[model samples]
Target chain A: MVKASMSGAVSSMLNCRASSLVLVLVLAALGGCGGASVSVPGLFPVPLVDRIPLPMGLHLDESLTGYVHAEELEEQGEWEIDLGSAQTQMFQNLLSGMFDSVYPVANPAEPGGEVAGVLVPNISEVQFSTPLQTRSDYFEVWVRYRFQLYGRDGELLGEWPLTAYGKADEDNYGMQSREPALQAAAVAACRDAMAFFTVQFRTIPEVRQWLLTEAGGPSR
Target chain B: MIRWHQQALATGCLLNLMLAGGCVTSTVQQVRESATGMNETESVVVLSRKTRPSQEETEADFVNCISKSMRGGKQRVNVVGEQAFRDALFPWFEPRTAPVNASDLPELISQPELAERLASLGLRYLIWIEGDTDRTDSSGSLTCSVTATGAGCFGFLTWEMDSGYEAQVWDVRSGNLAGRVSSEAVGTSYMPAVVVPLPFIAPVRSSACSSLAQQLKSFVLNEG
Candidate 1:
């Protein structure tokens, strides 16, 4: 009886050891899986809108054109999101569609005589949340953009801050991969920004004033 | 010889085993607020309500399911793709900018550009869907362990899922609330394991979608 009990105890100890080893390996694997580099798409569908009859100059600085958000998120490790090229491309498409004429200005401080006003846009903030963090079934992203409008003589006409939010259901992806879900969220945010900007542009008081002055002059 | 109670017990066990598979129950109701009708040229678009930040919006797949159902079947109602219609209207139909109520439609379409786009799409009805499916309750436990010879799971696990969705149909041409349809479904799923776990997943959301689509099709077609 003593011999049999000894053999059983040895087997149980061996099983416990094996389980511990497996748990350690899983933890190591999860720790090693922490970095993701994402690039959002630039292509967007043209919006349907009556073009404003004003000539606009798009001034994209190096920082806005090559913007990158890099952060270390505790257990999530490192994340690098490149939104510069995509934002630049989307703005080009959106502005061209909105204005009767859109041209690139070398500098916002000295917009040429050909354009009525110059629009300088920059990313104000980028934030994201994963299912692990929110304890929800969705991955979400939020982007804020600040647009500074400069008049013909390089005087600041107005500055508008636009915010956009997007989310992707984790159940839709059906996998453990986080990159695709985050990318989708980011793309959705960009689309939201485009939609909001297009609809609410004329509603902004300063922009409306600029439009009225450009179209009907100070008296009218 | 088998006793009467023993035979009854065996039969009961067999019946329970048969009932352990996927089973779901659904109820659908409709409220007609105004007259409704549809023509050959006129079509419908299914959109999820995303204006409210606090409320959970309807799932995209559920909207597509309703759209697809409307497009198919014997009645064969014309259905416009959501994304395409949204893109055609652009900013006007966006989440934040979309008209909140039927009363706001006139102001929205007052824009010549938006009016023209709406006319071109031949959109007669806009179905705005809201709600989601969630696991309401869960119990039991499942544990899996691996040995040198093999791996297996042991235990019985079960969960309850509930789906509730409401679709509001608007007659865009008239800018009137034609009707509203609601679908509610409840189901319990089971996973019983001795060695390998056997999953019997109840299609709660699918049931809700199917019932809602059926009711919506009938409601739209019946021109009273």
Candidate 2:
């Protein structure tokens, strides 16, 4: 009776081990075939500020005409990044703070009549690097732009090249999520770009001249 | 048990084959318009609307490939060289400064000089190809350490390349968007050792060029 009981227990243990092994294999197969995706959120409205009351027209260049969503795959799963309309909204918000009247090029009717000059913002490049791709601890985002000031006569007045970077670090030991980090990086990069533009726009000689001349005096 | 093992082996082989043979994915979007066929008498000009400083060489190669492919197609359309097209239109207009937007066609073609120049060239359509091919993602354990004799890397490294391109067609005579074609190709390349390098798992730029050219030919000839 004792021998029989021991034999039965050994057989049951072997069966359990075999079943667990099969289950793991099946799960591994499923994981290899499964697909995953990630997305970046759309642009939320930036804080509205009191208009500066200067006449300025804002035009997005041909390159900045549309939004793009980028995607990638990893050993773990699939990932997606939504570029959102944050680009357009960011510029609009920044320009609104500096100018009294802001006109979007999309609207043909609103060309900012009697405006001093037009500010054309061209998105030169947008690069997003995932942690898996860069082999880095953080997700990275970089945005490069060229801000050009054009006179009413269609002559180029001034141009400034601006670049911004954003990064989000991984949490403790693979516990972190990528989407939030990516979003934070992108937002930070945009904010940095805008801040750079704000400072450079005021200091650039050509821009200073244009603003001062348009305002009819240097004091304003 | 044998049958199950065989099934798993077959699945693994299939997966390996799929990974080894990278896929080419393309998308073509065109506005609803009357299919205007090309004839021997009329010609089409394929040009890069905006060639960045870094992409000049690639742009030139792309333009040449497209023109060559269009000429080789069954349509027998006269694909003009970029130089000839530039010579005909330069000084009067600059594509880099003012890209011809499909939406702003009417205003652009309304210019008398522009219309006359295009008409003189006997140009039926203008195809604008733009965008770039770049390395997007990379992974695996690849570490390089410098030794006294030389530098070497250990372990395996793999990276993904993405090629995204858009070709916009404009009906020169009507100043309307004839069509737009976009192609995207993605593939992963691997390097097992530091000494030996696997160039490209997928030929993205070539794939994009060939695919775009073929589609343009079909679009113009109304073959597809």
Candidate 3:
């Protein structure tokens, strides 16, 4: 009787273990089938950094034009990117840092107030890649923009093209959601692009000439 | 084993059907006035209202697409090139000074010289297209990583696009508004990938252009 009872207990233990294993396998399979998404994250306002003040009041044009390419996603998908509004915020921050007074202009042709120069920013291209495509376990985003600077008189000063790229990857064994990673990548790319513009804008000869001339230097 | 295979096949067929059917959705609205003054013999000129210097190329493209689509319509009508129309009215009228809303048509064409020049060109109807298409909402997550060999993206990403356009038709002879056509197209796109990326959504611009063009044709030709 003792031998038979012991054998019955062992059999019960084996069945219980098999049942638990099957449950875990089913849950894991379901988890693998779950879907993920990516988007631009909210940005905190950038504090004004100390920089050489531009002589004339600067105007940031609100109208932005560009194309977003995610054909598999939708036609004219770029319009959904909202890069214009993103750039507007970043450029406002940058211009406020460089100029004592910065104005947001709805119509560059008919600005409400007088401004020394108008800066038109446009996102030319955006390329987004998911971790599934890269297989590197990272999310990547790249953005390109064209900046056209016009003098107060509506004369085109010059145009500059800027580019930025961002990537997100996991450093540990545990993986986070891909959406957060993509959002982080997009935010980083925008910040990097704005930073590049703030630093390199002064280097453009036309920009320098326009600033100097507006400050009452030798008229060309 | 046979039952499991059947379940898998059923799931695959359902997914294929869903993908093929629910990719894009579009809607068009049009309003035509009852005044009978559109002459098929006279040419219709498509014009883009000048807003900013940067919009020049975009306006040109819009004009070209609308004119081409109108020409391809079953009820054929004379479509004039933008350059010829501009050349005919250069010194007297500018796109900036053109009437935006239908209400301003009477005051605009009241001037003798402007009316004469427009009449000489045999311009019967002017189609003014304005507004832009933009992306509205985006959600989902995508993770892409680069390796020495290549890059891969895993996860699903989806976004919504909206194309909003307003096309106003002006009858030049009567100096009256003939009709107004507005088209709004909204579509959601999805990118899903477990191991490989799958992109399945139609473009919004083409959909907007075609739908608007078709509506414009119906309005001009008075077709149901």
**Which of the predicted structures, 1 or 2, would earn the higher DockQ when compared with the native?**
1
**What is the interface RMSD, in angstroms, for predicted model 3?**
25.3
DockQ of 1: 0.20
The C-alpha TM-scores of every prediction are 0.86, 0.43, 0.44
**Candidate 3: where are CA atoms >4 Å away?**
A1-220, B1-22, B37-40, B52-63, B91-95, B102-117, B194-196
Candidate 2's TM-score reads 0.43
- Candidate 3 residue-wise lDDT, B94-209, digit = tens: 33344666667777567554577667767788888876655576666644443466445555555666777788888776777888898777776665544445554646756778
lDDT of 1 at B219: 92
**Residue B164 CA error for candidate 2 (Å)?**
2.4
Model 2 ranges off by over 4 Å: A1-220, B1-22, B27-29, B51-60, B92-99, B103-113, B141-153
- Report the lDDT tens digits of candidate 1 across residue range B178-201: 889999999887655576556666
- TM-score per model (chain B): 0.89, 0.72, 0.75
DockQ of 2: 0.02
> For each candidate, what is the lDDT?
0.78, 0.60, 0.60
For residue A77, model 1's alpha carbon misses the true position, in angstroms, by 2.0
